[model samples]
Structure formats: C-alpha cells, structure tokens
Target: MAHTQKLEMLERDDYLRFRLPEALKERFKLYCYLKGITMSDTVREMIEEVLKNEDLEKLLQEKLLQEKQRENSRDETDD
Candidate 1:
C-alpha cells in the first residue's frame, strides 16, 4: 500500500497578480519551479538581492577610499 501526500491549497484572491510578457512569465515560472519556490517568493528574493548588492557596493567604495589614504600615508612617510 502506498501513502498519499496531502497538499494545501492557497487561496488565489489572497495573493496579488500582475501581467507580464508571455515568454518572460513562462521562463520565470520554470525557474521558480526548479528552485522549489513560488513566483512571489522568487521575486521577493530578487529584490532583496538588489538591495543587498547596493549596500555591498557602498561598503566597497568606503574600503577603497581607506586603502588609498593608507597608500598616501606610506608615500609621505617614505619621502
């Protein structure tokens, strides 16, 4: 005898909807399915990644400035 797995049904109206190009929608759905995540979750993750990348870029710029200052100090000390 095989056991059946029970699945929960999410209410459609409870979620937001939007329209996209057919090709883009299909590709996004396929990617989401492969990652075992819902399309909404995938979109949310993408937005988070963009925000995190912006923060990382700002930090990198600060570090670069600090490195340049250190190089200038070393040059003055050598002179």
Candidate 2:
C-alpha cells in the first residue's frame, strides 16, 4: 500500500478578473445562483465544452495548415 502513494507537485489556481455591464453582471450572478453553481464553474464548463467540439477542432487545424502554407508562399516571394 505504501508503494501506491505517488508524489505530486502542488498546483496553484490562477485568477482572471474582468468587468461586464452592470445589468449583465447582475443577471449572470443571479442565474448562477439559481442554478446552484459558482460563476467560475459555469464559465469553465462552457470553455471546456467549446474546446472539446470536434468540428471546431477540425476548423482550427485547417486554419493552421492554411496559415503555414501562406507563410511558405510569402517566403518563396521573398527569395
């Protein structure tokens, strides 16, 4: 059992603070409260959901490939 204990490094939580319109802020606060979730949790879940989307991932990869091709073409023009 002692061998099962794994050593891990401590991690710190990062903070992000931003301001929104007063009315929107109030509405968001109340919505999260009614849903029984922290604002951070709701935001994190949304970010995760969008990032895990397969179509979005494909689009991002295609964009990257196109950008790389554009850079190569520009380099050829420079030479």
Candidate 3:
C-alpha cells in the first residue's frame, strides 16, 4: 500500500527540462557521480534550498519590479 502511494506521488511530479553549457554539464555529472547521488536528486535538493531562501524571493521581486519600470519608461518614451 505504501509502495503504491509512493509511485502515485512520483507519477504526479512534473518533469523539468533545461539546457546547460557542455563543460558545466560534465562537471555537474562528475560531482554527482563522486557524491554517489543521482543528478536529478542533486538538482532537486538545490532547487529546494533556493526556494527556502527568503533573500531569493526578495531579489526576484526586485528584478520583476525593475523590469516593469523599464517597460513603463519605454512606453512613455514611445508616446
């Protein structure tokens, strides 16, 4: 019963795909291999770490506000 529930939860998880430079990719692969961890697990842990960081959220919000201000400035110049 527990095994079936675990499988169901995993099935519901989303798949993420992205690209990286070849050298960076190779280095990450080697790091994971040396640590005896799967690349996906390592990436997931890193993502969780970032999500837990309060400063990251604040930084993202600041970046978004700056972008909106830039767009508004451009619109004003065009008018």
Candidate 4:
C-alpha cells in the first residue's frame, strides 16, 4: 500500500499594478465579463504564459521592431 500526502499552498497577497487607457480598461472589463472570467486570473495566466516562453527575448525584439516601424511610418505621415 502507498500513502499520499497533500501539500498546502500559501495564499498570494501580492499585487501587480499598471496603468492603461480608460477605453482599453473598459474593453478588457467587458471582455472578461462576457467570458465569465475574472480580470486577475486572465492577467495572471498571461503573465505565467509569458514567463514560460523560452523565446521571450526574440519576441520582445520583434515587438520593439514593429513599434519602431510604426513610429517611422507615423513620422513619414506627419511630414
């Protein structure tokens, strides 16, 4: 016969805070409501997934390159 023991986990009281545009916040709130999911869990899952990615650096570099290209296009349009 084998015996098994359950492990207890500690409660998480930490918070991650950031700012976003009001319109974006409202959209995210509505999306969560429609999906019947809490905002915290959605954000936590996204964070965990990002942390687990092995190609995060390449992903970040691609994002930065895209942003820079957008900025350049905007500058050209503004000229």
Please name the candidate that would achieve the greatest lDDT relative to the true structure.
3
Among these predictions, the greatest TM-score belongs to: 3
Error of 3 at 51 (Å): 1.0
How many pairs of residues collide in each model? 0, 0, 0, 0
How do the predictions measure up, each by TM-score? 0.43, 0.55, 0.65, 0.55
Candidate lDDT scores, in order, read 0.81, 0.85, 0.93, 0.87
Q: Model 4: residues >4 Å from true position, as ranges?
A: 1-11, 55-79
lDDT for each residue of candidate 3 in 1-79, tens digit (9 for 90 to 100): 6999989988886799899999999999999999999999999999989788768778999999999999999999999
Off by over 4 Å in 2: 1-11, 54-79
Which segments of candidate 1 are over 4 A away from where they belong? Answer: 1-19, 55-79
lDDT of 3 at 7: 90
Model 1 Cα lDDT, one tens digit per residue, 7-59: 22332335557789999999989998998999988887787798876878788
Cα RMSD to the true fold for all candidates:
12.8, 4.3, 3.7, 9.1
Off by over 4 Å in 3: 1-11, 55-64
Candidate 2: clashing pairs of residues: none
Candidate 2: Cα lDDT at 2: 45
Q: Rank order by lDDT, top first?
A: 3, 4, 2, 1
